[model samples]
Target: MGGVDVVYNPYDRAVNDDPYPVYARMRTEAPLYHNADLGFWALSRHADVSAALTDSALLSSDHGPLLDPGASGPHARTFLSFVAMDPPEHTRMRAAISRAFTPRRVAALEPMIRQIARDHIEPAVERGTFDFARDIAAKVPLDVISELMGVPPAERAGVRRRSDALLRYDPAGQMSDEGVKGILSLGDYYRSIVVERRAAPRDDLVSALVADGELTEDDLVAFLFLLIGAGAETTTHLLCGAWYWAWRNPVQRAAAFGGAIGAWVEESLRYDTPAAGVARRLTRDTEWYGTTVPKDARVWILIASANRDETVFPDPDVYDLGRDTGKAISFGAGRHYCLGGPLARLEGRVVLEELTACVAPDYDIDRSLIRRTVHGNVRGMVSLPTTVKPA
Candidate 1:
């Protein structure tokens, strides 16, 4: 890697397909890499990224989760979920949200999730060929989370379409009018549901938020936006990625079918980390990797790069299911660690188990039809086509 001559653009389609080679150069040539074009810094090493993730005192998340610091400020407080909060504010909201996702609560969903897996997969198998992402990967979490959030199954497609409009994450990327409208549409959609849930008071996440009494009407809708955006979408990508990666590595897929699904899931999380890294703002000038990053600079904590750091993971590029990924921060860590991790893992494990056992021992993914997401902030496949056969 002769000193990464290519300017690292997260939105670049070619780079997104396989970010590891570029990430290797970043970790070696510029651990505290700065992209002046995008006006942000990046920490590529596992040590550096992990430090920044846990350094809540220095790195801030109050603005938004996009890499560009100027993308959205506190003034645009319409969708600041706990992911975009700091300190006592984050603590209060996260604690409240955590209560709604207790381990017991998530575990109880196993039966429902298994049923959902069968409901989606069995049909896809019957069809013999289907786009895995649309038919199954995206459905389980959407159904579970939508139902959990009190949005009826009938409304899920509309919610998904609206939530997708929020792909306008960076100012560097031309913020299309469609994306802006999509964000607004989700806000309006959730606002209606919030009002309904408040009036009727059901035992769902939305009702729980409304009942918490800690959020104003505006905050209530914003929280709903956060729930759908963070919970459903991320888990969908995680499931999609797990399937895609498994297909790419037959040995690993076999191991997953051989009672090593947990290892496979963790390695997939580490190797093909969804959400390459998260955004943060520096509170004060900080010296890192022998350079002084200025105060108030935007930084993309490169968790994707860190997950493959040669220092921490030997032969980091290889997708070895036996590799210990206990230290991986794919779901993040510390204060902002994804509250949805356990639920996401539950979803991933259940789906993989069902696929390998009931759907087919192994099925080849249609590499030509698998379309990947080019979004700068998220690592996800939009489509993964595959043909399946009965067990």
Candidate 2:
């Protein structure tokens, strides 16, 4: 497993389907394997990834965190978000975002999140069968995030479609033309909303951003994209991925329904991570693994691998809802930890609660119809069909 077996080819569909084996081999056989083909270094071990995440001066996020071989950091349009930025610019924007997207604000979204999940799911239960990814899992996050942004109900569906398109890539692993178009469309839509919020502020995230008055127009738009791209898609994947794990393990599913839904979410974040990895660029020449990393080298911190490190979790691949996953770097570490993590967990809890307690307690996942998404980053199903047993 030394040579090609350890190469991290993100574009390969097979790797996306089941990257665990590849990551497992990489963790032991080649922890510091550098893919000259990809022209980037990788950090696979849990300790190294954890350390590099906080080592900002050595491993920088300024050049963005998602990429392919020979691709630029972040995307041309999404370069404004704090996730793609390094400090002190990252620090300043983070403070402004913290001021605007506060804990109190996200907590207020709980009731609304519950209501949104109920509104979308309760009706679908009557159908007996539907795609969970589309009908429920995807809608809950889209509407909740949109509602937080003060987007009207009439516009939520369009927003979801556009955002989904923006994050999708072609089967050949290239970013699609539609994705670029989607980005452009969102930019226009958010700019219009920003203008409206400026003249007459509302009690939504966008209005809050406008009120902050610190972020530039481009930065505001970038932040909005980050919210949807980072939050929506990954969250949708989490719900579906959690379902994939729990459905396969009815015991854990029952446990989650009983009282430990939060634990299930945490395990899902660890067992089947939503965002697979995050990238950081070297600020200057640095020494790692007893070797020198040249300045401007791209270091791919494989969070998925770190979370599954055998040294940390005895049976790394097993989906244990009761597993203690405090040390997992699913939401990242150090200065760039996920700000919306609390909200994400809250949403996950409510979603599982509604599905099991209210909507489909005896539902069966149509595993044959489940389809994993194709993309360079993030891991999730694009379609998950489910049906309730006949009463």
Best by TM-score: 1
**Model 2: worst 10 consecutive residues (lDDT sum):** 68-77
How far in Å is the alpha carbon of 226 misplaced in model 2? Answer: 1.1
> What's the lDDT for all of these models?
0.81, 0.81
> lDDT score, residue 323, model 2?
80
Clashing pairs in 1: none
- Per-residue CA lDDT of model 2 for 1-391, tens digit only, reads 2244666686677888899999998888888868776677888999999999899988878777765532345453363388877779889889998886578877777888999998988787878888989988888888888887888889887877777665764433365677768768988998888888889998888888778888888888888888877788888989998887888888887787787888989999999999888878888987765678899988888999999999999898998987889889998899999887888888998898877776444568877788887666677888999886433
Using all chains and alpha carbons, the TM-scores for the candidates as numbered come to: 0.94, 0.93
lDDT of 2 at 59: 85
Summing lDDT over every window of 10 consecutive residues in candidate 1, give the lowest-scoring window.
Answer: 68-77
